[model samples]
Target: MRFTTRVLLLQLSTVVAVVLVSTAVFIVLAVEQLKQEAETSALSIARTVAAAPVVRSEVALETSRQINPSAGELATGPLQSYALDVTGRTNALFIVITDGEGIRMAHPDPGRLDRKVSTSFEEALRGEEVIAWERGTLGDSVRAKVPVFAPDSREPVGEVSVGFARAGVLDDLPGLLFGVGAAAALALLIGTGATLVLRHRWEELTLGIQPEELVTLVQNQAAVLDGVGDGVIALGTEGVIQVSNNAAEEMFGLQGLEGMSLQELGLPTDVIASLEAGEERDGIVVGDRVLYLDSRQVDRAGQRLGSVIVVRDRTDMMELSERLDSVRAMTSALRVQRHEFANRMHVAAGLVEAERGTEAAEFLRTMRDRGPVDYPLAGADLLTEPFLQSFLGAKSMEAAERGVQLQLRDESLVLGEVGGVEGTEDIATVLGNLVDNAVTAALAGPAPRLVEVTLLDDGPELVLVVADSGPGITPGTLGPMPAAGESGPDRIHGHGIGLALSRDLLRRRGGDLWVIDPGGGESGRGAVFGARLPGVMFPGDDLREDEE
Candidate 1:
C-alpha cells in the first residue's frame, strides 16, 4: 500500500481499539452501579416497612400467641395489607412478613401465606438486617431482610423482606449501552477525520515518499557525498546551505555549515555573486588553497530546484605550471645558445679548412675574450651567479621575442647567493612575474621599450625592483593587494594572475609586493614594482659579517 494509506489505517485502528476497550469498561461499570442502586432501594424499603407501628404491633401480638396460623387467617390483616401497600409503591417483586417461628405472615401469592419462608431469616430474628441476592418462592432477587421490633423494645417480633427481580435490576442497562455505543461511534469518526488530515500533511512533508524510502535516501546521500574527493555544496533557492560534503567543510575550514547563508559563511562576494548568477568560476582561492568552482542551477520539469557547486583544488596544478614555464624558458635559452655555438664551430672549421691559420687563431682568441653568447643587456654582465644570470638571460631572450628590451640596472647587486634564502622559489616567482609584467607594459609604450630589474640582498632582507617604460599604472588604480591565498579581481598587469600569485607566495614567507611608483603622467611614464623579503639570511653570511 501507499505510505499515506498505511498511516491512515494505522491511526484509525489504534483509535478504534482504544474506543472499543473504553466502551466495554464503561458498560461493565454501569451494570455494576445499576445492581448496587437496586440493592440499596430494596434495603431502604425493607427498613421502612419493618419500622411501621401498625405492622410491628400486629407481628408482636402474633408472636406472643405462639400459634401456627393457617393461610387466609391474617391475609387481610394490617401487617399483610401494609406489606402489600409498600411492595406496590416501591415496585418490589414481593414483600413478605414472618413471625419469630420463621413462618411467612404475608406473601405476594395468597396460597403461600402463613408458610415457612424459603430463605434464611435467622440474622433478622437476632435484630440484624441482611441484604443479598437469594432464591425465594417468587424467583432469584436482590433481597433485604430487616427485623421488626415491639412498640417499646429492641427485641425482634417478626421480619420484613424486600426483593427486586434480577431483570428489574438491569432494566436500564440496554439504554446505557446504546448511549455508550453512540459516543464510541462519534469518537471513532473524529479520530478517522484527524488521521486523514495527518496523512495529507505527511504526504506533503515526505514529498510522497515512504518512511523506509526516506531513511534509505539519507543513507545514500551520506555515502555518495562523503565518498567523493572533490568538495560539493548544495544550496537552496534562497542561497542557504542545505548540505556540504566533508571535502567542502575541510577546504573551507568550516564545520556544521548546514542551514547557513552564503554571506554568513564568509565566502568572497565575487564567488557568491557568481553562483547567484549561475556562472562558473575557476582558480578562486579560498583559505590557503586555490579552488576551481563549477556551479549549475538544478531544475527538473521546469521547476527551480536550487543549485549545486563543485570545487576542485588547483594550487598544486598552478605551481606545476609555473615550474613548467620556467623550465621551458630555460630550454629555449639553451637551444638558442646551442644554435649560436654550432654556427661558431662551423665558421672556425671552415676557416681552418681554408688554410687561413692566422685568421682562425684570431677568431678563437676573440671568442675566448668575449663570452659564448653576446648578451644584449647593458649591465647584465655584472651578475656572476649562474642561476640568476641564466634565468635573466632566458627572460631577456623572451622579452626580445615580444619586442621589449630586458636589462639589469647598473646598481643591481646580489652581495651573496640569492638561492640561500629560505624560499628561493618564492623569490624566483616574485622576480619572474615582475619582469614579465614590466616587459609586457614596456611593449605597449611609445619608444625605447625597456624593462630594468635590480636585485639586492641586504643582510636581513632581499629587495627586488622592476621598472617598465610603458604607460604607468593609472592613479588610484593600484589598490591594496589581495590577502594571502584570497582570490580577487584580475586587475594587476592587465588580466594575468602572475602578480597576484607571486605576491601571495612572497607574503607566505614574510615578504610583500607593492608598487613604488604610479609613474604615468603627462610624460606617460611606466610604473615601478618592488618587493621585500625579510629575514633572508644568505649562506655563511654570519662569518662574512663577523670578518667585516
Candidate 2:
C-alpha cells in the first residue's frame, strides 16, 4: 500500500478500537447504575410498607391470635389490599407480605396467599432487611425484603418484600447506549478527518518521497560525495555549509566545516563575494592553491534546494603559466643579446677590414670574457645557476613592463647554487613573493621607482631580501600571522596573501620572515622585507668544502 493510505488506515483503526471499547465500557457501567437505582428504590418502598402503623398492628394481631387464615380470607385482607395498591401505584414487579414461618400473607395472586414464599426469606425473618437481585416465580428482580415488628414486642412478626424486574431496571439502557454511541461516532468522524489531513500534510512535507527512498538517496549521496576528487560544498540558503565531503575539507585544510559559513573558513574575499552573489568564478586563491569554482542552485520538484559549489585545483596550471612567461622573457633577452653580438661582430669585421688587427683581437678577447647569457639585472653575474639567473632575469622584464626598475645589489653572494636543491620550491616561492610585492609597491609609488634584491647562501640556509621605493607600511598595521594549521582570510597582509603565504612557507621549514626596514632603507625610501630559509642548498656543501 501507499504510505499515506497505510498511515490513514492505521489511524482510523486505532480510533475505531478506542471508540468501540469506550462505548462498551459505558454500556456496562450504565446497566450497573440502573440496577443500583432500581434496588435503592425497591428498598425505599419496602421500608415504607414495613413502617405503616395499620400493617404493623394487623401483623402483630395475627401473630398473637396464632390463627392461619385461608387464602381467600387473606386475599381479601387489608394487608393484601395494601400490597396490591402499592404494586399498582409504583413500577414494582411484585409486593408480597409473609408470616414468621415463611408463609406468604399477601401476594399479587390471591391463590398464592397463605402459601410458602418462593425465594429464601431467612434473613428477613431474623429481624434483618435484605436488598439484592434475586430470582423468584415472577422473574429476576432487584428485590428488597424488610422485617415487620410486633406492636409491643421486639421480634419481627413478618417481612415486607418489594422487587423491581430486571427488564424494568434496564428499560432506559438503549437510550443511554444511543447517546454513548453518538459520542463515539462523533469522535471517529473527527479522528478520520484529522488522519486524512495529516496524511496530506505528510505528502507535502516529504515531497512524495517515502522513508525508504529517502534512506536510499542518502546512501547514494554519500557514495557520490566520497568517490569524487574535487571539493564539493552544499550551502543552505543562508550560506551556511550543510554538507562537506573529505575532499572539500582536505582542500581547504580544515576539519569540522559542516554548519560553518564560508566567510569563517578564510576564503578569499573575491571568492566569498562571488559566491554570495551566486556567480561562478575562477583563479580563487585558497591558502597556496589556486582553484576554479563552479556554483549553481539546486532545484527539485518546484522547490529551491539551496546551492552547490564544486572546486577544482588549478595551482599546477598557474605554475605552468608563470613558467611560460619566464621563458618568453628569456627569449626576448636572448634576441636582444643576439642583436648586440652581431653588432659587436660587425665592429670587429670593420676593424679587421681596415687592417687594424690589434683592435679586432682585443674586441674578440673582450667578447670571450663576457658571460654567455646577459641577465638584465645589475648583479645577475653573481648567480651561477641557470634557473635562478633566468627566473630573476624574467622578473626584471616583468618589472620593466610595469615601469619599475628591477636590480640586484652588488653585495649579494651565493655560496651554493639553488639548482636541484632540497628546498628549491620554498626558496623560489619566498623570493618570488617578496620581489613581486616589491615591484607592485614600486609601481604604486613616486617616480624613480626601483626594486632591489639580495640573495645569500649561508651553509645549509638561503637568505633573500627585497626592498622597494614605495609608500612604506606601518609595522603594526599588518595582521599577525595565524598560528600553524590555522586558516582564515585575515591573513592577507596586502592586496593578496603575499606576506602571509611567504611567512608561512618560511616558518614551515623552521625559517622566518621579518621587516628589515619598514621604510627608508639603504636603496630607497621603501619598505624592506627579509627571510631566512633553512635547507635550501645541499646539506653537505659546507662539509665538502671543509674537507677540500
Candidate 3:
C-alpha cells in the first residue's frame, strides 16, 4: 500500500481500539457507582423512617397488643400509612414494615399485608441494619432494612425495609454511556486528524515518495554510478561532495570522499575553478594522467541543485593523437621524396633521348652512389641512422618550403641503431615537436632565419637539442619547473601543447626535457630546447650488430 495510506490506517485502528476500551471501562465504572448510590439512598431512607417517633410508638403499641391474647389483632394502620407516605414521596420500589416474627405488618401491596416476608429479615429483627440485593415479593431490588425500636425501651418493635428497583437504579446508565462514547469518539477524531497531518508532513519530508520507492531509488542510483566507467562526482551548491562513484575515487586516488568539500579533496586549483564556474575543460593534466572534465549545473523544479562533474581519462587518447601526427609527417615526407625522384627521372630520360647515353648512365651511377639529393645541411652526413636521416630530410624539405634554413650541427653523432632504442616513439615525439617549433620560430624571425638540431645516441641515453634564431625565453612565460622524478608536465611556457606533451612523455619514461641555454647563442640569440632519454641502450649491446 502507499505509505500515507498505511500510516493513516494504522493510526485509525489504534484510535478505534482505545476508544472501545475506554468506553467499556467508563460504562462499567459508572454502573457500579450508580448501584452504590442507589443502595446508600435506600439505606438512608429506611433508617429515617424507622427513627420517627410516631413509627417507634406505634410499632411498640402494636407489639404489646399482639402479645395479649384478648387484645385482638394489632392494628397496623399507622405503620401502613407511614410506609405508603415514605414510599410515595421518595419514589422507592417498596417499603414494608414487618413485626419481630418476620410477618409483614404493612406492605406496598395490600394483598401481601400480614403475610410472612419472603426475603431474610433475621438481622433487622435483631437490631442490626442490613443492605443487599434480593428478590422479594416486590421483585429484585437494591434494598436496605433497619429495626424499629419501642419508644421507652431498647427492644425492637418492627423492621422498616426500603428498596430501589434494579431497573430504576440503572435507568440513567444508557445516557452516561452515550456521553462517554461521544467523548471517546471526539478523542478518536482528534487522533485521526493529527495522524493525517503527520502523514502530510512525512510526504513533504520524503518528497512524496513511498518507502519502497525510496529504497528502490537508492539501489538504482548505486548501481548506475558504480556500473559506469567514467568517473562521476556530484556536489551540492555548497561544494560538498554528495555522491562519488567508485571510478571517481580510483581516478583521484582517494577513498571516503563523500561529505568532503572540493578544497578538502586537494584537487588542482584549475580543476576546482572549472567546477565552480560550471565550465567544461578538456585535456587537463591531473597527476600522471590526462583528463577531460565536463561540469554541468543540475536543476529541478526551478531550483538550483548543484553541479555534476564527469572525469574522462584522456592519456591514451593524447598518445594516439601524437602517433597520428607522426604518420602524417612521414606521409608528407614520402610525398616530397616522390616528387623529387620524378623530377630526377625526367632529367635522366631527357638525356637518353638527346643521345647522351653514356652521360645518362654515369648520372644514374652517381645518383645511386650518393643516395638522394643533398639539401645542404652542414652536419647531415654524421647521421648514420636511416630513420633519423629520412625524418630530418623530410623536415629539411618542410623547412625549405617555409623559407627557413634547417641544419644539423657538427656535434650531432649517433654510433647506434636508433630504431632499436626503447621508447623510440617517445623520442620521435619529443624531436618532432622541438623541430617543428624551431622551424616555425626561425621562419617568424628577421633575416638569417635558422633552426639547428643536434642528436646523439651512443650508449646510455639519447639526447636531442634544437635551437631557433628567434626570441629567447622570457620571464612570466612559464610556471615553476617540475622537480626530478615528478610525474606531470612542467608548467606551460609561452610555447603551447607541443612542449608540454613532449615534456610529459619524456618524464614518464625516466627522462627529462629542459631549456639548457635559453638561447643567447653567440651568433644568433634565440631559444634552445634539449631532452635526454635515459637507459635507452642497455650495457654491452652493440649498436651495429643488426646492421652487420
Question: What's the lDDT for all of these models?
Answer: 0.79, 0.77, 0.76
lDDT (10s digit) by residue, model 2, range 1-548: 88788888999999999999988898888988998889889999999998888788877777666678889889889999999999999968999988787788888888888888998888987989899888998989889999998876668988899999888888998889889989998999999999989998998878888888999989999998998898899998888999989988887789988989988777656678788777888756566566678888887798877899988877666665544544565566667667777888898899999999999998887766544445557677766554566668767877888888888898887766564543655666667767877887787678998899988888778888888888765433443332311232222124434455566557778999887776743544787788998877753456568779
Residue-level lDDT of model 3, residues 1-548, one tens digit each, is: 78799889999999999889988888889999999999999999999998999878866776776453121132337677778888999999998887677677777877776677898888987889999999987788999999999887778878889999999999998889889978998999899999999999998766678999999999998897988899999998898999989888876668988999877754556668988899987766544456778999997666677999998887678777876776677677677667777888999999999999999999888766544556545567777565677677777877888888888899987766554544556666778888887877776567788889998875768899899887654433433343211222223222344565667787877888887766433545777888987766433335346446
Give candidate 2's error at residue 512 in angstroms: 4.8
Least accurate 10 contiguous residues by lDDT in model 1: 476-485
- Alpha carbon deviation, residue 418, candidate 1 (Å): 6.4
Supply the TM-score for candidate 3: 0.58
lDDT of 1 by residue, 1-548 (tens): 87789778889999999999999999989988998999899889989888888878888888999566678786867777777888888899999998887788888888888888998999999999898998888888999999999989999988999999999999898899899999999999999999988988887666667988999999998998988899899998888889999898887788988998877765578788998888888767655566778888987656677999887777677766665676676677677777887888899999999999999999888766554566666577777655566678879888887888888888887766555533556655667778887887887787889999888877767798899998887543334443432435334355335555666666777788877876788867788888987665364454478779
lDDT of 1: 0.79
Candidate 2: where are CA atoms >4 Å away?
51-54, 69-90, 105-115, 135-137, 151-154, 268-273, 285-292, 315-387, 421-429, 472-479, 482-527, 538-547
Judged by lDDT, which candidate is best?
A: 1
**Superposed Cα deviation of residue 218, candidate 3 (Å):** 6.0
Error of 2 at 176 (Å): 1.8
Clashing pairs in 3: none
Identify the runs in model 1 with alpha carbons over 4 angstroms from their true place: 1-13, 68-75, 190-204, 208-219, 236-242, 276-278, 296-307, 323-411, 415-428, 434-454, 458-462, 465-482, 485-487, 490-548
Clashing pairs in 2: 266-489
